[model samples]
Target: MADLKLKDLRYLVALADTRHFGRAAERSFVSQPTLSAQLKKLEDYLGVQLIERAPKRVALTAAGEEIVERARRILEASEEIVELAKGHRDPLAGQLKLALLPTIGPYLLPNVAARLRKQLPRLELMLYEYQTDPMLEKLHSGEIDVGILALPVQMDGLDSYELYKEPFTVAVPTSHKLASRQSIKVDDLAHETLLLLEDGHCLRDQALDICSGADVNEKQNFRGSSLETLRQMVAAGVGITLLPELAGRGAYGAARGVTIRPFVKPVPTRTIGAVWRKSSARREAILALAKLIEAHAL
Candidate 1:
């Protein structure tokens, strides 16, 4: 560790992440030979082999894995320090990564992103459309700086701030008997086939939990890989489905024969929130994104 420079640590960490010397070098903006040489020096200083090099790929040794884990935190901290210093001059002038849940991303990101780019001109925003599990993983791993997801996640080691609560609505075919009803109860669809997104979607789970007796995989009629697909299926009279309030607006406009009606008494709702690792160093950036989302959602 005595002779190990910050640059050398960085090269090793990059190699660990990319698992390719050439690509790591490209990411570090250094020549392959230079990065390889530094890595060799670091290994020599440690008196152990850190990487197993082959013609086309590289694998980390046990020691390399441990060191790389620590190196990632060091690099994160170093980057945070730089950002903090820069923010002293301008509060928002660095890269920010925000993860959005699949259900919400398509419906909300476009309108929000346009306003964000205009307001924070220097902020380089990276958007990731992800599901609940992967979104939380990225947040904890520092791969993503913020996440927009439903509340009641009850995840440890992260903080969530509720942006708003959106109600669930019933999606039915325009010609269906229940289409003209101002609001439909869960029991209204109890006898009808219920279309839902696949298992991975949180909304699917929400729908099932809300309607205890409703059949989710009524193979004869239930299916959709996305909200749009569900809307289309509902329009085709395949089955009725539940949709979030945010998605109801204009969701049926493009589809041929569908209508969105609110729920009757005891409606189900989901709380959407901004989530970040409690230990994150990018507090300001995370808060800024949360504020942006809240403003745009309004």
Candidate 2:
């Protein structure tokens, strides 16, 4: 299989990720026709039908899925080799790919990124935003160097270090009765319909977990895709939702038409941390990033 090319494998992986030819091509920084022609050659060389092409979508065949998995390992190994060869150099000297969950990215990235520029001027940081599921999958596959997200994640081959604990606050429309309260308790949410992030966000799961056994029912048939959207809804007096402490009281705080209140003693909080594959060669850099976040995260 000397005819096999890593470039072609990357095209296939990109196709698998996006499930559309044009999107995959754009992601790979190539034209759609170039990507299509390369994959066709790859399939011919391997004697396997790797993709099932549809009019508007594409999916991997069973063999394609298996090969893509092995291809990811190969790609990650290639990266590790490059990183290892540079071991004598500064660990954070090269381009570092980092991902953050959507909920955390918007609130924390501004400050963190500004500082990363000043602190590691020689390092080029590539940032990406993803939901928890894809973020974890990329971390496991080494598609990203590290991920900053809510902790207590079930990552089998990964380790994480806590950066900070950000408490949850109740956010309601200015006219809501609870808006008059200076503080709230987890139990006080009982009988109130809570607005939460749509499914698949770790923040949503955390809210559900915190509300478990407290008899607080999530609003039926209504789910917000983001904290900002939820805040806008709250401003319009749709319903109430919980927000991270930073979103409530940090420099970016003060969304008009919403009131924020904290939980009393034993405040409900979520641990924020950086996660990376245990085998990552950039452990030192990742830990260094974690330290910076520990200092700046609220």
The residue-by-residue lDDT of candidate 2 on 122-210, one tens digit each, is 67778999887899999888899999888888979898999999999999889999899999888888988788988888899888888
Q: Who wins the lDDT comparison? A: 2
Q: Model 1 segments beyond 4 Å from truth?
A: 1-89, 213-222, 251-253
Q: Model 2's lDDT to the true fold?
A: 0.87
Compose the digit string of candidate 1's lDDT tens values, residues 10-84: 999889989998899999999999998999999999899999998877899999999999988898999999988
Best by TM-score: 2
Model 1 worst lDDT run, 10 consecutive residues? 214-223
Q: What is the lDDT of residue 89 in candidate 1?
A: 58
RMSD for each model, in Å, please? 14.5, 18.2
Total backbone clashes of candidate 1, pairs 3 or more residues apart or in separate chains: 0
